[model samples]
Target: MTEDSAEYLQRKEFYNRMLTVYGRKPVLEVLQDNSLEIHKLHLADSNKPAAILDDMVKLAKKRGIEVCYHDKQALSRISKNSKQDQGVAADVIGKGFQSHQSFLSSNKKHYRILALDGVTNPQNVGMIIRSACASPINAIILPEKGCAKLDPLVIKASTGTLFRAPILRCKTLASCLKAFAESGADIIGLDANAPHTLGEEPLTGAKVFVLGNETEGLSSDVRAICNKHVSIPMLNNVESLNVAVTASLIAFQGAL
Candidate 1:
């Protein structure tokens, strides 16, 4: 390949691993983290003089990181959440973040991925990431849409595990699942009504346990692609467990 083509591929790979964190506090926290690989610090040009902003700039300078200023509109485009961005954003390289295709291209013979389908609550997403990180799960399939965006609340809820968690991002859960299925993965969905329990069988090969939305379980598109359905059994006439709790169970299923 030509030098320009090689450079483009390298840049694409670098960006695939980067997660842009917005909000003043979140940007500050990321800047303060010396262990993190910060690509750049972004601030709205209209931001008023403030101690925290100054601190962030100081920290970036101390770390030899680049600082960029942009108009409010341009900054919002970078942060994607104009209302909550607080006029500050930072691009932190998530060491564990990559495209699902990258993970599939790996030589690993066996792997388990926990997929979230339309789990919109940031807290729930954070808690799920925490659980997946603590367990034997290989990676998390986080769809870019129909899921909680990675923000301060999610980072806080994960107890700061979001940065270290192996997150495989995709454009849509249904499409990603279809790709996984084509690659010989067993796509399992959690349903309270399924006859089989979560740990009833020992699944081999590539496995993906999908957790659905809080109130609506799985979306119709996601449900249509599931290879099988399993439920977590409970007594006392309990119908179901929270999606986060279910994720925890699935995450630790290998241990149990």
Candidate 2:
């Protein structure tokens, strides 16, 4: 391979090991935390310098982090949430986040991952991430669209676990699950009406537990791809647990 291609591959591999934290305070928090490893710092050129921004730049410089200035549009594109990114973002190379393609390349043969389908509530997403991070679940499959964008609210709701969670981002939940199923992974959809109970699940092989939206449950497209369906056994005629609650139960199921 040419030098440029080799460099590109190296960068890509590095990026797969990182997660981008956007918003001014969140990025700053990650930077201030000495435990975290930052790959690069991005700032929008249009942002007028303030004390916080100045501190960020100085800290990044002191830490020898590569700082790149982009225009508003470019920075928004990098952060993936233009409205809430606050013209700042950083690629954090923590053990938590990764790309699905890179994650699948690992030699691990058995694992449990959580997949969100049309879950638009930031709080729910955050709680799910927190639960997954704390449990034995391998990682969360976050779709690029049709879900809540990772924002400050999500970060807050996750109790700051967003930075330390193993998250795998994909372009689409359905397509990603389909790819996983094709690769001999077990794709299980969480449905309240499913005949199978969560406790009865054997939890074998490489399994992905797909959590649907709060109200509508799984989308037809996503549900159709699941190899099986499972539900939590509830009592007292309670209709169902919140999506996040269900996530917590499923995430910890293997350990129980």
List TM-score per model, in order.
Answer: 0.95, 0.89
Relative to the true structure, how large is the alpha-carbon lDDT of every model? 0.90, 0.88
Displacement of the residue 43 alpha carbon in candidate 1, Å:
1.1
Over the stretch 1-256, how does candidate 1's per-residue lDDT look in tens digits?
6656968767777888889999998889888877789999999999999999999999999999999999999999999999999999999998799888778888566888899999999999999999999898899999989999888899999988898899998889999999899898889999999999988858567889899999999999999999999999989998878899999988888687
TM-score, prediction 2: 0.89
Error of 2 at 16 (Å): 3.5
Segments of candidate 1 deviating more than 4 angstroms: 1-6
| Top-lDDT structure, candidate number | 1
Span of 10 residues, lowest total lDDT, candidate 2: 9-18
lDDT of 2: 0.88
